[model samples]
Target: MEKDLKEYITPPIMLIVVLLAISLMFIFPVLNMIILGAILAYGIRPIAFRIQSKLKFSSISILLAMIIVLIPLILLVAYISFIISGFLVGFFSSNPNLDMDSVISQLSTYIPQNPFLDKNSIVPTIQSAGKSVLTYLVGKLGSFANITLDLFILICSVYYFVKDGDNCYNFIKSFVPKEYNDFFERTVESVEDVLKSIFYGHFLTSVIIGIFGAIGYSLLGYPYGIFLGVITGILQLIPIFGPWPIYWALAIMDAIGGNYPRVIVVLLFGFFLSLIDMYIRPAISSHHADIHPLILLIGFLSGPLVYGIVGFIVGPLILGITYAILDSFRKELQESK
Candidate 1:
């Protein structure tokens, strides 16, 4: 036992462990960003390689690939922010002397009156809730510097991961026992499939659905249709939430405003959106690994709570990859037996 302990846990190993612990302490704050970067790199690598073949320069290819993948994402976020701010500014500016009672009375016109329910009382509650939500969002936005730093780190991490992913994989492979080399290779392939499965099944589906939503809403003559579509797409990414919420909310608003015809139209459009997802998701995901919906559901629901917004991407991918590895391990065990 003493000899085994000395052989396995020598001074050098102890020193390495101490160094790793210290390194983790520094990275713990931005670990989520780093993980997200690596995942993004996996998606970007093929694009980088394709670009490299044409550009004949590895660095330029990687940078261009990053831009290709990331620019739309950055623009989407910026556009969403712009729309939200613009809407708020327009609403308040246009209604400088906004009358709460008048608004309530207008709403009450389309709403069925109930003697027990006081519509007037709900106005204060709604105002308080809106204020609280706005304050929370503003407080989050106040951490601009930290957000910038994390983004910088994420970009750097992605660049290196895409550029040197092979080296990283080889380094990790070196640590695996020769007997487990086949297992490691199989696991790697499985993980790749998992990544593909999630990217195509979830993200791509959301994008398609969002496009459908944008066109439908615009055709329906809804203001800010693009923003509504974008929100619908984001909601589609979460298992518990889907295009239903957006259409349902719109329907409710239209109903209250006495636009009953538009409400029915939007509801039908939303149902079409949902129905296509049943076909689109399976078609895109069928070629790759099959990850359980439950795993993704847990990841999507729990990821944001732990890692903030990026968790939406990181959570499901991480869980899917973990599942792949475990499944690979099980196969290896069965083969051995």
Candidate 2:
């Protein structure tokens, strides 16, 4: 039976419209989960495949990969959470040694007197504001349900992305016209390169700095050096201002506590790490994505402000692809002329 052209075109057109409507309905999610999942899938795909070759089971290989990747992440998050909770508990407790009156007096010294505002009233005003914020947040505890749902979605998206990423790519590519397949392929390669450079580049640098920081802190006799180093390494994901503030803050505390020698040592090690950031990151990432560090830095800063945590990854990815696509389009036009 010969189908009419309307029959051939109508289904696909309707399917596309339905998909578009569904996407519009869920657009509030921002698809950060999928983007993150894709990046993770791409990074870990080779390792997963190699493991599968040895094991002769894709499912088991994927399980092993997930364990390898997720366990550490879970541990890190748990550890940070513990540290934060402990700090908060200690801070809020009414320990006799805390001496809040003296602390308030010390804080008061920093506030300059203004003609419009009373110097004595500033601390109470800040305290009132803090209490109001605390109350507001305490009332919002119910919102944790939403955060949990988002995390669940993220985890599931990552799992599926890893499992069916290749199939999904093919499915998407099938929609492209054959005449533009070459351009599409080129764009994919370009985007892939940029993602690898940014994501893997940050990952590699973070591990290096984290390990180095751990070793340095341990040698310098800093307490909980490994934990602090781990945190430091994680913070390296922030560009231009990676982990320096933490080190500086620690050094200031140590100096105040009369550990001048230790402070100097920490500062020197931090400076060395800064050099690695300046040299190694650019050297590795430039081969694939020769973008300015400022682009990434701005992305990290403004991404969180706009799109939340996922913006850190997506911001650079979006900027890189936008440029690459524009360049490819220009080339295609020039060639046609």
Maximum-TM-score candidate: 1
TM-score of each model, paired residue for residue: 0.89, 0.84
User: 241, model 1: CA deviation in Å?
Assistant: 0.6
Q: lDDT of each model, Cα atoms only?
A: 0.92, 0.79
Q: Per-residue alpha-carbon lDDT of model 2 for 1-337, expressed as tens digits?
A: 3577667668778898899999877955747766776777776777788898999988778778877888988999899888778877876784747876678778878788877768777778777878999997886686888777777776677667777888999999999999999888888877888787887678788888888888888888877788778888878988756779768988998999999988888898889988888777877787786666677777777877766777877777777777778777887888889
Which pairs of residues collide in candidate 2?
A: none
Give one digit per residue, the lDDT tens place, for model 1 in 81-192.
9999999999999999999767865765666666765767566655677789999989979989999999999999999999999999999999999999999999999999
Cα RMSD for predicted model 1: 3.4
Give all candidate RMSDs, comma-separated: 3.4, 4.4
Task: Flag regions of model 1 displaced more than 4 Å.
Answer: 1-6, 99-135
Best model per lDDT: 1
| Whole-model alpha-carbon lDDT for candidate 1 | 0.92
> Residue 50 of model 1: what lDDT?
99
User: Distance from true position, residue 250, model 2, in Å?
Assistant: 2.9
